[model samples]
Target: MTLLAGTWDGVYRTTGPRFDAAEQVLDCGRVLRVRQFDAFDGVFAATKSGLYHSTDDGDSWTDLDVPREEVYSVVGSPDGDRLYAGTHPAHLYVSESGEEREDDSRSWRELESFQDLPSREEWYTPRHRNEAHVRSLGAHLDVPERVIAGVEVGGVHVSDDRGETWEERKDGVHDDVHHVLVRGPDHYVASCGGGLYRTRDAGESWTRLDDSLDQTYFREAFAHDGVLYAAAARSSPGTWRGERGADAALFESVDDGDSFDVVEYPGHPEEVVLSWTVGDDTIVAGTNDGGVILRDGGEWVEGGRVEAGVAALCAL
Candidate 1:
């Protein structure tokens, strides 16, 4: 299988079981997300430079011309007719024609309703000069009108009418959300800086799931074949560069979010797993230290390494 790694330097491609031969394909800087949805025909990379689309696997990419250059998150509508992009300044934009339109015809319009959230005034962080970012975006095929957004230092919010209106869902969950993993029409897992949360009623209510673990800061969560996987560091990114490194841990859950068992891997306390994708029969993961590893038959195996820290991954 071919794997794509979105890293701080650029986008890399490798055919693995091993990724020693991974090569840079796109020079876009600081890729935060590399994703492919079943409803969309191409892969998308959200980067500091801009939002890009790759129709020919990871070989080539096209800039989607999002109004803002620092796109942090992207998602497609359930029917693939629309596209949504979230920027570094905590702004939301929607493209009515998606990527199917000609270059000249395609356009993105700002979703001003998102700025009207009740907690908008509190969406700042000292890390980014008191500015926030829309770090994650998600949409479920079962609910086309529903769009969920996770803002870094902001909060988790939902739009039931496809970005036309929004409601705050951050009451029970932490405000520093990093990623929102959509599992069903009304079910989601929010990986936050303070904790990992799950909502069963489309964000109306949430439950913390990381109380049994030592790690409090989470980047992303993945669910496949009834198994849930998550990785987290002891604290935020500022503490990730010390002698002990990230002090990270990887957790596996077979009973949804009820409980978790820490899994041992190569770079235990030094490297944190930042991205995940499924191959033919193995679960592939990318780490902040540029390490690639896979799980086969319940055993973790090393899968070579890339040149730069992998922030996101996609398997095809």
Candidate 2:
């Protein structure tokens, strides 16, 4: 079953080029932040107001009852029966029933604090509702107890009891983390304002890996076929505008996050944001501009472009 995508104003089926704006699945106003669209069971979106779910192939959506609207990220369990939503002003919300929010059976499970990391209220600073956005999330395939959340202003948080309690990993990680990816049993990568960083000790300590990459804005990172890939955008020193400057191509890092090699695309180096590996060899990249590019085999194909821009992409 192929999934659908389009501008924030509309939604489209992946099998065709035509789009139906009537089926604009997600709302942009109430949702201050939206992340993690799982196309298999449904799409999971987090907003500053609350959480939303779209199950009718992105035709419509419902809001999940959450404590706060400042949700940074949403992660689904391997079974797709439940989801873990992380909020800024730091809070963890769990939905045991991963169904439409309209479903009354769904309940919100809030997790208590973990480790000696400062509480969310203690680190309260004025920033965008999304400023403390949960930048990245990953669940261990082999170890079900392990879950990780990368916060923008805060460092990393790990939950071993499936979101029951959280612990902050403050060793070698930068306080400002842009994204995170779990590579293996003992390794993880984080992209930050400083550059690419790797931690062999489960985020306890990190090592900088920016020497091979041109100093640019590291927007997003992901893993595919056991190879690490990061997407970055070249920016002007003053303001972060892609229209006035050239963006960087995608990069591949084979040896964990130590180094990188830029991947070539069809157009001039354009910036790409969120991406996901659909199959063993397919990658779908969502660009800042409302465009989607699919990488199959050794080539890239333009899926479509939306005026409002592409926020995120995931395989169905």
Candidate 3:
């Protein structure tokens, strides 16, 4: 399987043997997220400028005319036809069904009255209009009707009606949810600002599980096989005492999300750990500066080094 990574310098691609780099510099200032539409054949990258699609594996890219340029996440249907892009100020864009064009401005929907919902004030405190930043989106693996979204400064939002309506599912969850991962029916976990939290009741309630991870910015979480993995980055610590210990860490939980054991590394401690994907039993952890490493039986093996840093890793 091939993995795609987007960074400030450019876009990168990796397979079994070689690491290829596509110099798609972030002239627009920043690139928030990146994803491959179909395996490694096509990629969708979001930056301050706008959304871009690379069908030729980053050799060339085309701008996707999303409403807002500050897109943080993008997800395509399982078939890679229907595309959905989420951005700051709470905007959603749907591609013109089958049309994919650079200047093609499709119909866009803005979620404005979210704070008017019943649980708005309680769940989304300091309810600012553009603060409901949607960071991540995932289509349920088994359920087509359920669409999960992760919002910054706000808890998880579940849309059982296919993004038409959303409800705050933070009953037992802490605020400042950053990422969400769905494993099965009730097996789902969220990575919040404080740490990682898991809920068997979908998201009605949650229990914090970030004691082992020393991070105030839990960026992403993923599950493969029977193991659950989470990435923690020390962006802004609660106190200055923990500033010297600021480093990224990747944790693995074999018995679901109950407890975790640190996947030790030989180099410097990691910082800003991102997403990962598993192949066979080899778990790969993408970090801000430490490149990628393969978690073997009981050790972490160096995968390789990247000059632009790793954003997300997914197996095609």
Candidate 4:
């Protein structure tokens, strides 16, 4: 088994969710995403410099040659032959499939069509330069041909032809999408800068599902066994940096996101869980204060800690 984690400080790997056992595999810049692929027994980490991949557990890493300096997200095909990287300024790069990547370095090809998605002229970032970013990528495991890209401050884009072409869908969502969960060809839930949006009929339409929460600034969400979990703050990342912290908290929904209620845990009323993943039948989360928490058998407890906010987690 292999588990990889990304944090604002660096990227680390461990036997599982045990942070005490984690070893810093890379001392590079902020790690934003981590992906594990079984086909090559490979682990991939995205950071400020470029994309790095390790085929031999986390003992070694090779930086894939790509022009993008800030890689924010990554996803792999179930077969492990294909890989995709989403980066700053809202760009997507895909690896050439159906070949062994053991000795390949410049294996990624830029998909130029992504920049032509609808309202392409309207996407812009508020805090930085006048450019948006691809913050998250979701691939349909059940349907390998479909993929979704969540653009921060730009909305979500769906590709039925596996990254060759894309259709922009922002009907029930604000332009600022933080993460998108794709359960099927027609089912998806998007947690955005404005609120949470759900779609039962693919990308035809979406409905805001965050009416029960006081804050609309939602970034991440996950669903399992018909139960949906999400977190929210008074605003964006600004809340996590302040002294008081965003009135950040978690919530659960049994009605497929129609409504939600607070999900109690240790120190339930404080702190924000920014990243999540599942490990050995338990729900795992990382907080803004460099904390890792897990819910095993319905009880929540601390797993360990990092020195900065956890950006991503992957278990394989």
What are the per-residue Cα lDDT tens digits for candidate 1 across 1-316? 8899999899999886678898899998899999898877879999999999988887888898899999999998988777899998999999885344665324889999999998999999998879999999999988898899999999899999999999999989999999999999999999999999999998899999999899999999998889999999999888999787789999999988899999999788789999999978678898998999888778777888988898999997
lDDT of 3 by residue, 211-280 (tens): 6656657877877777787767666433213435447666778988678877666333535566576655
Ranking by TM-score: 1, 4, 3, 2
Tens-digit lDDT track of model 4 for 257-292: 887887666544467777788877778888777778
Which residues of candidate 4, in runs, are more than 4 Å off? 37-40, 79-81, 98-103, 267-269
What global local distance difference test value does model 3 have?
0.65
Higher-scoring candidate on TM-score, 1 or 4: 1
For each of the candidates, the C-alpha root-mean-square deviation to the true structure, in angstroms, is: 1.4, 4.0, 3.9, 2.1
CA-lDDT, candidates in order: 0.90, 0.61, 0.65, 0.79
Error (Å) of candidate 2 at residue 303 is: 2.6
lDDT of 2 at 44: 59
How many clashes in candidate 2? 4
TM-score for each model: 0.97, 0.80, 0.81, 0.92
Q: In candidate 2, residue 287 scores what lDDT? A: 65
